[model samples]
Target: GAGVSQSPSNKVTEKGKDVELRCDPISGHTALYWYRQRLGQGLEFLIYFQGNSAPDKSGLPSDRFSAERTGESVSTLTIQRTQQEDSAVYLCASSEWTGRNQPQHFGDGTRLSIL
Candidate 1:
């Protein structure tokens, strides 16, 4: 089965531009999450979606960052008005809902560069 898939392994854009990153979770997984890892920084949880409930967006740095997931499958994170500070590797993960004990499987991530 496909572990996970993220688009544009790398992305480069100018300030004030927008970029959309996509993620595809493994089949039958019931949990999906998005995280960002800046240079030399640890993973920061961005958003999480489970089933069809509202997404948890508390980790979003600003209104410029947003993400959505459909049922327990694909997800997309959109970064609007990109800024140099927003440049980082955006990672997506998914796993079975066996509780916190179940580890998340991550994608290679989308490296965004704001120039």
Candidate 2:
């Protein structure tokens, strides 16, 4: 894909259900990020991966949230024991390895709803 690609564009699950969101970044993009946006709120950074270095998960909200990336290819965000507050748009973005100011290419995002 020319841009970031996310799966299950929309997902609806029970409150306690577990959900997984996937992201496939553009080829050659070594930097990837995951974020959550609540209604009328700004994007909340969740995790970041770059090259072979350890992923920076400092922004993960809780132990229930986790992410993994296979090299610089695909990434997955998993949420366990989902809560109603988890309803939001989960966005994925990727950028060339430049600097923090590098422009990011984002996906349409996965709309997750915990009912």
Best by lDDT: 2
Candidate number of the best TM-score:
2
Model 1, 1-115: lDDT tens digits are 5688999899999999989999998898888999999999999999988777788889999999888887787898999999999999999999886379989999999999999
Residue-pair clashes per prediction, in order, are 0, 0
Off by over 4 Å in 2: none
Alpha-carbon RMSD to native, per candidate: 1.1, 0.8
Models 1 onward score TM values of 0.95, 0.97
Predicted candidate 2 versus true structure: per-residue lDDT over 2-113, tens digit per residue: 7899999999999999999999999999999999999999999999999999989999999999999999899999999999999999999999973878998999999999
Error of 1 at 94 (Å): 0.2
